[model samples]
Target: MAALIVAAGRGLRAGGDLPKQYRALAGRPVLAQALTPFLADAAIDHVMVVIGPGDNARYAHAVADLPTGKLLSPAQGGATRQDSVRLGLQALAATGFDGIVLVHDAARPFVTAALMRRTVDALQSEIAAIPALPVTDTIKRLGSDGRVAETPPRDTLVSVQTPQGFHFKALLAAHEAAVAAGLSGFTDDAALMEWAGHPVKTFPGDPANVKLTHPQDFDRSQGAPLHVRVATGYDVHAFGDGDHVWLGGTRIAHDRGVVAHSDGDVALHALTDALLGALTEGDIGTHFPPSDPQWKDAASAQFLAFAAERVRQRGGRIDFLDLTIVCEAPKIGPHREAIRAAIAAAAAIRIDQVAIKATTSERMGFTGRGEGLAALATATIRLPEPE
Candidate 1:
């Protein structure tokens, strides 16, 4: 299955200088938070986003540090939300996608894995399915004359939310038909399905999946101060017969290489472990085993990226990554800033958030003897305090 995230709206009502999806929620962009679960989900095969024109820069910055291997090129959006959905569906169809597609709202970033599972599972027996919460308040309908007109029973009412799941071809055809018929007032895709004579099933919705709209929704106090976690990681690689070495995503000229299953980037390996430690996830070996033949020559930058995505998956952000490289050769003085930039790009944080230092072991340790290189890294992160 695939997902199409609708983030094309101006969202000025959210009171941010940028679009609400590009604005910060917790410590990362709202759209990043919204995209994390879907990207991390095993059931989803592809994810695409619809963006407004002139939002290219904002969109790039929003998902800059995320693991987006499955993300397709963003589709340009039209004027209204309905038009954006139709265009997004059309774009997906152009890719020859005919499987189920989940249409989600960018404003609702709290979408959970379980909620997505429920939505997807409901589609097995229905042409269309949506998540909805039962209404509990009294209903009212007033006359245009400013008088009480009628009150309907609240039992029949429900508030709907995305991601609304549907057969891609079915929904695309319905949208085309609606456009041909000059239908313009439908509030959601579900309503359009109703107009096209498709029966839409309802699944239970999550109340915590509220949309962030008002300015106060981004207030730190409303969500409480995040939990601060500090963790350390260390890695060492012995010199072997090679002409180059990889460190922090950079390939440098060297007389020898490190013995390892992967590219043997000690800096990124240590940083990846430090971030996993901060998230209390296992070390690099746990996620990527040395015994795995597929990772025999993989780049370490992707390892760092995977670890960083785990933090985002848990609703946290990396604050700082401080690394100290211990070596007697390769002279770290010149590449300090380059190493920092590479680490920052892999970990999805600003360069200022990364710190790199170098030292020699006073000509006593193995590092001082020039047999190998070692890296020590400490990762600091902020996560929503567990309730």
Candidate 2:
């Protein structure tokens, strides 16, 4: 079966140059997060994305790290949500897959493997299948005055989500008919099929597979409380006049630099935060204190390698890392790629798995005064669930 992911929404509600699907949630793009399970499944043949016209660059930036062998080029989306869905259906029509087609929203990133498999099963028995959860709250209709008009029966109400599956041909025909009839009020594909006289089956939905509509949604992540850990490190060196400064793994030619016990790589220091977070260890300072004198001038890479080896020894794997560098003088853009490479190399992971970014304190703090560079990082690791 094939899948078409509708990620074309401008995400006006999420409010950013980056759409909601492209937003970072748990250190990964929301769209890439949604696509992972489908790509890993053996039954899925290919996947396509419906995106805004002239935003191929945005799509490219969002999916740069994903293996593109299974991805189709972005199909041009329309002004309305329905238009985007219709366009996605049209694109898949050309691929000529007679098997079932799964339509999913790029904004929903928490879909699970079991739910995805069940969606496919529903398609085998019914022309269209949707995943939904019975509404739990007592929903009420509100009038212009902002008072409840009437209470809707909760038992009959359900909240729906995508990866909505269908017999490939039937879905295509329904979309074509909807467009031809000028009936565009339908908010989802299942509704369109219903209006076209097609019966859509329903399956259970994981509450965690939420659609990210605003920034706050990211702050509330659900699922197995990802084995979370935090580590902090601190390095202080005397100020000295020098031509080169190293922060997080980026090098800048400057007039003065922090004299350190090692390279004074602030980027690595922040990465240690995430690594520690994953390992549930303390910060960099806890592991390597300045009073020890043994680590003076130690290469921060040594600290990172040691941490990684320790994590492996404990039977865990690092999934991704987010590192941010803060400094005053030497701009960061020129060295971003190099910094990414350095972290990935130290972690023994792909460069794409490491995100390196830079920011300034707006000259407000010590870093703003150009005293020294600072970094903050968050890391994710996966360990076997307890037996």
Candidate 3:
């Protein structure tokens, strides 16, 4: 099978300097996200991306790092998405792949690998297969007076999405037929295939696989393809008489101790806050209240670890952590790498993703007076969509 990703649309509906497909969602381009599943599939022989003439330089820059073996950029596109698709199909047909053609929209970033596979399977028996989600809302036809003219049966209604699959040869013939018939108003490839007398089967579609048609749509779906967030934190503990102090899960003897009910590991506290902030959950206090006796003198690192694991179990991934320690005494430079490693191990992420920095208070405040130590941390996590 091969793929033709229609990205040449002017996106006038989306309205932006860059076409909707080239815009950034999360940290990657929308088209990139949309193409990932197909690129990963061994069955997809190649992928042709059709772009507008003026977008050539930008398209190259946008997809410069994508795999070249199965990806291609054909000549500049015509005025409509259907024209762009036809151009892409001609390029694919030239490549001699007549197995199946999967036509996808570059604006639908949330199309999952599973959905693509399902569509491919359906194409094995039918001339064409389109992902169509069952509509859950009431159906109505409005009159010129803004009244309901006819109520269609909701049971038979379905909202179609892509990557709509078709036999490569059949799809090409269908498009050519449509062109010959002077029909250019197809909202999707399946409809065109149906018009050409090819049976198109329906496969399950993801509700979250939404196309970005307007500015608000992009805003709603932009971000890591996963539904995750990043947050940061910082805290300080003053020095006072105490038996021992905790630092990144290690006990250390100190002249003065941080004043807190817990071990007063300011670094861990800040990081905890950051993690909770990312989850949009309440702060550490809400989870482990100071009012609770069982938490008194409890390890703050433990609390942070629990929060990290909670997000992990929720199908989320922490991408990075940046921790900074500030104090004049109990020098932090020696423990930087060790602390970073420890944090990474606890957060279940790579060492490179975790950073630890140290700075002196410059003798300017309570920390400068050597009364306490302070630490701040930032956490970046990738949260997958809820099942």
Per-residue lDDT tens digits for candidate 1, residues 98-145, read 899999999988787778889999999999999999998887889999
TM-score of each: 0.64, 0.60, 0.60
Ranking by lDDT: 1, 3, 2
Better of 1 and 2 by TM-score: 1
On lDDT, the candidate that comes out on top is: 1
**Deviation from native of the Cα of residue 20 in model 1, angstroms:** 1.6
lDDT of each: 0.87, 0.75, 0.77
Better of 1 and 2 by lDDT: 1
Q: What is the lDDT of residue 143 in candidate 3?
A: 98
Which pairs of residues collide in model 3? Answer: 26-223, 26-224, 228-383, 238-372, 239-371, 239-372, 240-257
Error of 2 at 340 (Å): 19
Model 1 clashes, total count = 0
Q: What's the residue-level lDDT of 103 in candidate 3? A: 89
Model 2, 206-248: lDDT tens digits are 7767888876677765323445443444443434778888765
The 10-residue segment with the lowest total lDDT in model 3: 341-350
> Evaluated with TM-score, which candidate comes out highest?
1
Model 1 residue pairs with clashes:
none
| Candidate 1 segments exceeding 4 Å error | 220-222, 229-387
Positional deviation of residue 379's Cα in model 1 after best superposition, in angstroms: 8.4
